[model samples]
Target: MVVDRASSTRIVPRDPVTAFGIGNVATTGPTTVRAEQQVSTDLVDHRGRIDLPALAVLFDHLGGLPYFASDPDGSPCVQARLAISMQGGVDVGDRLTANAELLMHDEAFGTTRVDIVTSTGRICSSGTARNVAVGRTFDHNPTGDRGAAAPPGNSDLPGLPLPPAIEPGLDGRVIIEQIAAGTRAAGNLTELLNGRVDTVDHPLGTGVRFTVGTEPWMGNVFGTMHGGIIAAAVAQGCSFAGQANAAAGRDYQVADLAICFLRSPAVQGADVVVEVTPVKIGRRVASFDAAMHAHDGTLLSRCSADVHYR
Candidate 1:
């Protein structure tokens, strides 16, 4: 399916996660996709900047477009691995656009690269998404109407509800203990996911256990938790773990994150648990591993992250 970049032809979102997270989307070419969103306060981090995990959600959406474009049968695909690197900062109210290009693909796997930039032409983030075919064909069209484009602004999109309201006074800083105790809110992306830090006993020191209730809005077209949301959850777990291990008076940032999806958890309003463990804590850098599990302890995904201290 060839999409003319100059025409009004756009890819309509079939899932709530994509509609709510990335806003409007379009297939600019046979191998390229574009998405746009005006950053809102609910998308910012404690630093009042666009959250990395939120960007991961966006990456996950745009990254999957090329595979759909290239497949003639519309084979079912799932995210295999995702890696994102932080480049610059983005604040609330900033209009951001993401462009994704297909790198390579085979019968079993496909890889796509995405770059996010602000209206001011500032690069905000970039990443690559790897997806694997599931050996099945879609029963129905999963991409929705490719010829009809939604009206300008996300509010005009039919059934696209407003994002959850962030509690006032939530500055992007997450206090591990406070959030775990339910005394403070993670706000922003975590708030949107209804993520809560939970207390759990583990052999790994300086770790965190996060739980999020899966809602329909968090699901993919298949009615399961979206891969990008899973990635965001893993990122949050790693961020909390790194913060807990950092020395006093030191500041840290998530340098990069990579996650692999092993299983899909149905979004039945059940709680999904994410456990993070410190792999190594160096003077200038720290590494951590995270695992996402169903409430019954079924491992769903795994992630590794690196944090740079300054």
Candidate 2:
């Protein structure tokens, strides 16, 4: 894809849009987008920590926000891939900032560089995404229906109101073992979940409490947790949830996964508690909601997933 040299000249600086205690503003050029925000959170988890997944969405959006704002036309772009790497952990009252710049572009494709930093001048995360310009202006504005909405099944409580008890028929240990085995086959899956996760008395569908490991490759640059790992945990939760509600031996495929960060879990000595509950059970499709919390019981992130069982 070719970067548009002519598009960069039609740039604008707009007012910051503030919501959920964060303010975001952007400046764009024809072929590039850069955005900045002072991260703040009006929402808090049980540990009184700032939400983790919610923050991720905001930061992630900031990385792409400029592309739409500066588009010569009003059309919004569709993200094909989003990759995130966290170097540091952020907390409540900790300011998070992001800069998203277009690295490459053409009529059909665009690549962007995304970075997230904290107020203390620490780089929290860095990543990139490939965007497909859908050839239409963004039809909605942030001030109204087009703006951010609460994630599906999102609630004030950080975790499931009634954590599922270990079921009698399924062996929770075997399910956890299967998960561990599955992750081992995936790149760095062993390191991601290893001894960190615990399987209770129930089966794969049961909830597990995980301790954040201090492996050298573990924590973010700031010696805290990374959102990517958290996503992995949530993915496993959804997989198990869907599998549990499906016919025996059925394979589950994740169709969509969306998470919101409410607070950042501590990188070290933090325990992650996640429970996945099936929301809908159709013959082929299933929906699940997963909640994650820090060891101290404060909510960190929430996930909504759609899975297909075949």
Candidate 3:
């Protein structure tokens, strides 16, 4: 089943909590907002723990809302970039609460800080974002009702690539494809998001390859994982690899994660391979790179993460 993401990029001033699966659970202060999401079975890994990639994107949507409220109908607030760090894992049906604070919002950039905690008040994840005001506003309606106006198609914009367009219309509505004129097709990075795990012996040390399936959930409108999730997949695998190498070693929180999406993966019928290579294992900070690939040896995407090991 395809997820409807028609208005995900509008950057309008409204309640995004309803758009994403998370709910606006509380408001402690003028600048503070809290959201909670009930993790379902589809959102979890094989171990039934919340998938890091899925959780990371959730942080982006949930954390950005309070800051977006600061701008509302003013500047077009867009999440230019974000980074997430995981401290622990959450399971299915677990309620994840995110408390966000608007750090700053100006004509140029917007930033926010978010902390995600479990029911017992365990800090599981933290995030910082750098968003920008694009100087353009879409149909900003607080009621989320455009009121009978034909929404702008992704292709109508000058150079903005539309979200992966699920083609041919599922039910009499045709969604335009988002690839550029000369853009390349790798596989749906999001489709490869439903992750799988298999252990492999390595000459350097022990290696674990993480794989993922496509579709249903964990995909953008284009039907693939988001760039954030691509990076998180690497971090997730390396976190596993790091833990394996660290056995009785120090636990680390991801301090830095970087990714380059070489090609868009297919939306269906493909598996992504996540192979982690430890660049440096130090007493202070350890680093690793996870490559997302196809079974045919195609390099779909890649990411590198730095962790505070101690």
Candidate 4:
């Protein structure tokens, strides 16, 4: 499902972020987009379920399409806020489809909703994104050739090397320890984006800081860190931090996550630091606050998430 940009007057450049994160997508109308992919080993977490960061990438990709499609000038829009809630579960080998619709829009901003459903009609996840026009316009014909090269295929994108496999049924804390000790990988999505759990401290109960290296594959069409990747880093930080603070013999899951993009981080091989701080740690539920910063200390994004104990 290559993007059907033929009818449009603009040529959106192909970037590695879209190539790797969004695989294949199609636009049904000016206000809707659809994408499909199969759950593979690289898309699953240690528990063999789809990872939240992977869902964030898909949400960001499809959720921005409606805004792009409705704008006649093809002006670029950056996501101002993104929120997602996981309702169901999906695992490896499941086929998934995402449908996105434009919920509302005005001159300066637009809101879009996307729902990811499995083959059995289960709603795996649902999310909404708010995007604001950046006040910049693209060339009517940037390539000067309407018949420009097509988007890159899978072969053209960089492959995510599988991390060292971990033993099955390991609890979250054990996995975190293994990751910290360099004994196990930090799952597929983290490895794909060069994310690392750098430090785990017990200050104020528990605090976790992770770093994601700025690689070319993590850049958006504008050459900055993709909003989805930023959200992914935040999700990773919060999840690990929550695990570090969870009670023994108990497990937790992210119930909801919201992210606000304050600024974009340049993809210059520097590390984006994500610091996770606990807001409240309850027996039934927990809340966390995460902040992402550039290597030079410039704040990039802020996120909040809720985790439910099980």
TM-score of candidate 1 on Cα atoms, chains taken together: 0.81
Query: Model 4 residue 15 lDDT?
Result: 48
Q: What is the lDDT of residue 117 in candidate 2?
A: 76
User: Which segments of candidate 2 are over 4 A away from where they belong?
Assistant: 1-17, 28-32, 36-38, 69-71, 135-137, 140-310
Tens-place lDDT per residue, model 2, 1-310, is 0112456331211111222233434455554444444333223321133323334444445545555554665456655555555454566455565677877776677777777677777986676766666644433543232223322122321221221233345442454555455532211222224324444334334444444432223333233344445655665555555544655445445555666556546654445777666667677877767788776778877877776655
> Per-prediction TM-score, please?
0.81, 0.42, 0.55, 0.82
Positional deviation of 173 in candidate 1, in angstroms? 12
Better of 2 and 3 by lDDT: 3
- Which stretches of model 1 miss by more than 4 angstroms? 1-20, 46-48, 137-140, 145-174, 199-205
lDDT of 3 by residue, 1-310 (tens): 1132575442321221322235545556766766676554434322223445546655765454566567645444545556667777665456677888888877677778889898789988887776665554344432133112222222332222223332222211011011111132212222234455444455554455767654334343334444445555665666555544543424445566655566546645567788877677676776777788876888876677766655
The lowest-lDDT stretch of 10 consecutive residues in candidate 1 is 154-163
Q: Model 4 shows how many backbone clashes?
A: 0
Better of 2 and 3 by TM-score: 3
Deviation from native of the Cα of residue 229 in model 2, angstroms: 18
**lDDT for residue 116 in candidate 2, whole number 0-100:** 69
Question: lDDT (CA) for every model shown?
Answer: 0.70, 0.49, 0.53, 0.71
User: How much lDDT does candidate 3 score?
Assistant: 0.53
TM-score ranking from best candidate downward? 4, 1, 3, 2
Clashes, model 2 = 23
Better of 1 and 2 by lDDT: 1
lDDT of 4: 0.71
**lDDT score at residue 287, model 4, on the 0-100 scale:** 91
